[model samples]
Target: MEDNVKELIEITALVIEVIGILVLVFGTFLAMGRYAFKLQGEDIRSFQKIREEIGRSILLGLEILIAADIIATVVYDAQMEQILKLGLIILIRTFLSFTLEIEIEGKLPWKQEKHRTTGKK
Candidate 1:
């Protein structure tokens, strides 16, 4: 039973890792396709939009990869070492995500300005 559970967790982690890669690949392709097809005269704006979309996909993919890393850590023999390594991995990935978010949105996540919706009749 214990071995079975461990095997299941390892498999789950592998699946999650694959999903993360797929998300990054497909998201990037979709973003580039959209930019190619929906060309606008505003060159800078279009380029920036594609960049932001790609960055967003990277952020999400990193988050998913982090989750897979955590899941994979569960089966490691050296619990303490694995936990420390996982912590470092999470920290680095989190920093990357935050930086990508700032690059995409031009601000920190907490400092985002809420758009007030006006009630138009």
Candidate 2:
């Protein structure tokens, strides 16, 4: 019974991973197509839109990965192992989401160009 549960979890994890990879690849192609078709003055705006779409897609992938982690942890039902696995997944997904948010925004939240020009730390 337990072995069967583990096998199911492993299969679910594999499927989730494959779907996430496909999402990333498809998102990349969509962004590339958007950039390739847009012309001069509109290119920047179009690309920015593409970037936002890509970020959203990546976020969705991250969400699926998180779900898979949770499912695997539940299957294990071992306290220490489940905690560690879930913690790691949460940490990684949080960082990925943060990065995607910044990329979607087109700049660091509090970073200023003036700071760069003056070389102040």
Candidate 3:
């Protein structure tokens, strides 16, 4: 029973990681298509919008990958070394997410929507 549970968790984590990779790849193609369309239409802000969309997709993919890492490390193999590695991975991904959010939104994640809605900063 215990081994079955571990196998299930490992499979789940692998599935999540695969999904993340798919999202990242799909999003890249989508962004590329949009960029090409915008370029043909001579839109001045095409690159900016494309960059923002790509960044958003990457951030989302990173989050999903982080989830997979957590599941693999914590649920499938709860060794101290694995946990520490997971922590470092999570930390780096989190920082990347933060930077991407700022780059795409021009504000911090917590502040972006709030400031837009409230007009306070």
Candidate achieving the largest lDDT: 1
- For 27-63, candidate 3 gives per-residue lDDT tens digits of 8888999888764255557878788878988999999
Error of 1 at 114 (Å): 3.3
Please, what is the whole-model Cα lDDT of each candidate in the order they appear?
0.88, 0.76, 0.84
Looking at model 2, which ten-residue stretch has the lowest summed lDDT?
38-47
The C-alpha RMSD in Å for every predicted model, in order, reads 3.5, 8.2, 2.9
Candidate 3 runs further than 4 Å off: 39-44, 113-121
- 2 or 3: which has the higher TM-score? 3
Cα lDDT of model 2 by residue, 62-93, tens digit: 87777777666656666897688679877999
Better of 1 and 2 by lDDT: 1
Please estimate how well model 1 matches the true structure, expressed as its whole-model Cα lDDT. Answer: 0.88
Candidate 1 backbone collisions, by pair: none
User: Which residue pairs show collisions in model 2?
Assistant: none
Evaluated against the true structure, the overall lDDT of model 3 is 0.84
- What is the descending TM-score order? 3, 1, 2
